[model samples]
Target chain A: MTRASRLYRSSLLVAFAALALTAGCGKKQAAPPPPPPPPPPPPAKPTVTLQAAPTTIEKGGSVTLSWSSTNATALVIQPAIGNVAPEGSTKVSPDATTTYTITATGPGGSIDATASVNVTQPPPPPPPPPQPTLEELFARDVHDAYFDFNKADIREDAKAALSKDADFIKAHAGIKVVIEGHCDERGSTEYNMALGDRRAAAVKKYLSSLGVPADSLTTVSYGKEKPSCTESTEDCWQKNRRGHPVLAK
Target chain B: MIRQPRTPRIALKLHWFFAALLLAASPALAQDWFRTGTGLGVERPRVAVADLVPRAPEATAHGKLFTEVVRGDLDFSGILELVSPSFHPLQSPGMPLQLNYKAWSDAPASAQMVAFGNLQESSSEAAIEAWLYDVRNPSSPPVVAKVYRGAPTDAQIRKFAHQFADEIIGKLSGGLPGVASTQIAFISNRTGSKELWVMDYDGANQHALTALRTISLMPRWSPDTSRIAFACYIQAFGILSPQICMFSLELGRPVTFPRFHGSNSAPAWSPDGSQLMFSSSMSGYPEIYSIDANGSHFKRLTFSAGDSASTSPAWNPKTGQSAAFISDRGGFPQLYLMNSDGTNIRKMDLPDMGYVIDPAWSPNGQLLAFSWRRPNGNFDIYVMDVTSHQIAEITRDAGRNERPSWAPDGRHIVFESTRGGSRQIWVMLADGSHAHALTQSGANESPNWSPR
Candidate 1:
């Protein structure tokens, strides 16, 4: 009975195989497949260039730092240049030989460029040309201007002396001078300091009006500390209250 | 100590009787007899400072110094006349238990209050048991009973004595602490440059505070006594720029540079400890300016420009309502007043003393002390009543007196003078009496008394 069943199963399988082959040979294609994507372009390379105008300078001199970058979102300079625009310039006064590096960063990554500034020590300035024997002459030219008791205003007679002094200062434009305001030993030290400052300021104002460079003039108040005369007499006090000029080297 | 050790009942009975006697005597004697020796219509309280009993014989020197300093401090307070040690009873008190209050309150000495202590010194430190007793209240406990220990150097002994004296004053004067323990900050040229220095109220323990080695001047202490602000010349922009700097005692360094654009000088702390008044030339001319404690919120107070300059502002300490400053708007430096906000400017009613400068308002806001120059060019310290404009001279014929600063107690003043052959810092009673040199070696000036 087993042999008879096996032969029947084999005949049915052959009939099903013929039916399946006829159905598959009649199927149709729907559409052609889409083309593959083009290979990705190489990542955009960020570029930067840093340049220093007058790359070599004497000590204490300044240089212009210029930078240009493309395909970058941010730019920065190191060694004190700090953050900078992608395309910009700045003035830098490097005290020493310094290599300034600029880094530009973007989605593509970071690119760096560097420029070095060489600071050369300036040669000694010819020993200052053997400073003239002008101390006594300058002292003679600058006379002490007097003031009244408890008064900071330039006395009427002091204008002549101050005018001559201003002329001398204008004659020697290179010389810097200090006007010391002194007070008689007749007031509080703290108050005298203020008084002294006022006197010196008055002298400075007068000198500036006379064409002396304000920058070349500075004032200090000696108050009652450096009295020209130590006596209690009016004459001594009159002498003590004076605005005297000092030469500043 | 009770001489009879075994008679317990008798001792109790005696104690009760003594207590009863004290309760009866204290009200009348204690109230009316309390005095500051100034004799300014007030009775001088009779107080006695006993020589400190030496627990260690070697500490006798320290004990002597302690007793002397305490006596001197009390005397200088102008509040009490010390009962001389010769007048102290034979049964001297080394401790509160041994205090013979009945004896101290009796006879010619009749000291209402007595200070007694025991001093023991080792090589490095001294242990002190200081006691102050209301001798009039024989049976009452000591008004002040405490132990103080510190280094036993001469300076330490003096400091402890000052503390003890201050304690006594606090107890006797309705809790008003005396200025015995305070310090005076002054400018000195001891190190070849005008620098800041500090000394105890009695002119002891003088020491240099800043080593800036530049021209430092006008040291003024903050109200909290934590910092000393002074004017110093600093090199900025290759030039000597005068700037106000502060030396912090707690930080042991200069905490403030206060670098305004121009010269800054004459720093004075506000009474509330919130701001400082300094003269600045930042506005192209020197004028009074106020800045906060941290050097922010700089506001100019005096608006005078050109030769009409104003500076040296002294803020009122009590109410912080007014300030006294020197201004030359009238062609001469004279005292001027304005509100703390730099408003309500007015001229002070000062006499024709030539020029008035360095106006320091008293702590109580009652008086303003300043240096007034006579026509003879002689500077003397004078005080004027803020309310009545009554002038009182604190120093006369004293070689160039200036920069009078009032102590926190409002009863004393410190100033700089050439009276002692050189410019030295001196402390005196508010009445200009008992002037004593607080600095000796160098030309010290501009004494700023601390608040505490």
Candidate 2:
């Protein structure tokens, strides 16, 4: 139907339509309520800050560990310092350089930060002065004191030699000497060992009496094990029975 | 010379003379020889060791080894002399049943006793039957008739022979068994370093007891023979220091004891095995100290002030009541005697040899053997009569002989000598006669005879 002609023909129907619309309008109407404005963006994630006082220190020194965090219900520090409050500080004395980390967590998410300390080592000491070797001391400065067969008594000649030895050893403040008592190829091994010890001790005693430090002298026995001369003659044996002074390091 | 024969009168006279000779040579006649005179020099019994006869052809090698070992043991016993096999009769004494008393009594082999053995051998084991015969009285039973069974290896054969020899000595000498089965411990550097070693009394089967690979000296056996106390150089704070260490032969390892601050050396066990005596430098100078065997009661035996040194303590094996030690209190090293309680110290009455050291007491407590050096630097082993103070030279003109240790029987001594071009162990009569090398090779020293 033509829109205008249909409208004229439906005038009467239109009036009825109007009355029905008015009745319909009188009934409760159905429509979507305007959507609530989009929810506000979620709150930003919580943040944390960890710091240590005295960032640099010498060995055996201590440091203060401080931390701050937001929105975290619980927090902890690893490696022995277990649990701690969200915002607190503690002291630590780490033998070595170390780093500390802090973490914060919430419904928005989590965040972490760290701080470190530096350490410095002390400088090494200077090298000591060169020391005279045992060979040099024995060969150049000290003389062996000869003794009679099986005798530990200091002879006049031995006294002269030992005096020189004492003087040389005393001039060097830090130097110590060991008196070795030796015997010729004679006697029981066990007895000779003791005899040698006595000879050395006798020399040590003589040296000590001469004002040498007693602690700076020691004694050992070679018995007949180490003979300076291998020949089985009187002269060789005489040479072997002596108190030999050796430098001790 | 022409012979005068065919007379019954002359033959009767000869028979009487022969009978008298047999009586004079009897063991019973010589039994009191050692106790009759001054007991210094007595004739050793003449013993003939017959070749060990083999029961089987396969046993010949082992039988020879056994015979050699037995002969060596008897020779070294010092209480007997082994009649050379060269003196044996032409006919072999195949077994005890076949032994001819007249043959053993012949000239050059008139043995007072004869050791006869028979060996039955298999692939790995042997049964040895040893019998000691009284050659003078063949009608009487054997002195020792034993059957020993063991593996026929060289070591086992030697062991069986030693056991049989010990039995013979015990029966004949009426003293402690022969040291044939005993072992001597000494120091050896054959492994490139000085260490403790043990061997048969005859120097067979020598093997290291301590492989410490460091210097170990003076291995002194405990009275009970269960442990060896020695001075071992151990690393302490990176320095080689001598310390007294104990090794248990039963445990086959080192044992722990109290550690002193300084040197601890020259360990000797008390006769009763209740305590240990050692020299310690803990008091600034080497001095004698003693501790209970379990290391409880630590007591200083010497308290010398200053640089005086007292060391090398040897306890009397009988009572542990007296000790012989070396001290520098005298102008030189000299032997000193002290009570076990560390009191009543006295200078030993020793010869004025320039230096006197190493005093070993006899098991019978009669003599002290030590080395004495003369003004000419000649050292000799001199045995001093502890009571009479009579000193006798045991060794003379032999390469340096030292460190004399008395055998358990007190009739023989073990010592060190350089007479054979090298330091070696030697065994001799207590009077220093019949010196024979116990160790043939290597430079063996510091021989300590085991008291078994």
Docking class of 1: acceptable
Chain B TM-score, candidates in order: 0.87, 0.89
State each model's CA lDDT, in order. Answer: 0.80, 0.76
lDDT of 1 by residue, B1-452 (tens): 11333345534543564343233222233322222322112445689988889997899999999899999998887666789888889766897878777789898778888889899999989999999887877777878888989987887888888988998876665555788999998888989988888888888888888888878888889888988888888875445667888899999888756586555788888888899989876666678999998978999887874567788998898889888888888777888999988999998855343678889987878778898885456878877767756666668886888888988877788988888888888888776678888778967888899989
Tell me how each candidate scores on DockQ against the true complex.
0.30, 0.10
Q: What is the lDDT of residue A211 in candidate 2?
A: 83
lDDT of 1 by residue, A1-249 (tens): 556567666766776676566657756654334334334444566899999989999999999999999888889899876788889999999989999999999777899999999999898777655655678779777898899877878877889999999999889878888887889977666677777777888888888988999988888777776798999799999999988888876
Which sections of candidate 2 miss by over 4 Å?
A1-249, B1-46, B101-112, B135-139, B236-238, B257-264, B303-309, B350-354, B374-377
lDDT of 2 by residue, B1-452 (tens): 12344346534643554353234323334432222212212455678988888998889999999999888888866566789889988766756788888888778898878898789998878999889988877788888899999887889999999999999877766545677888888988788777888888787899888889867788888888899888776755323456778889999887987777445677888888889998876555668999998878989998765566677788988768989888777655778889987999998754333567667888766678887675565567877666656566778898777778887766677888888888888988776666888776667888888888
For residue B39, model 2's alpha carbon misses the true position, in angstroms, by 21
Report the CA-based lDDT of candidate 1 relative to the real structure: 0.80
- Show pairs that collide, candidate 1: B35-B43, B35-B44, B35-B45, B36-B79
Top TM-score hit = 1
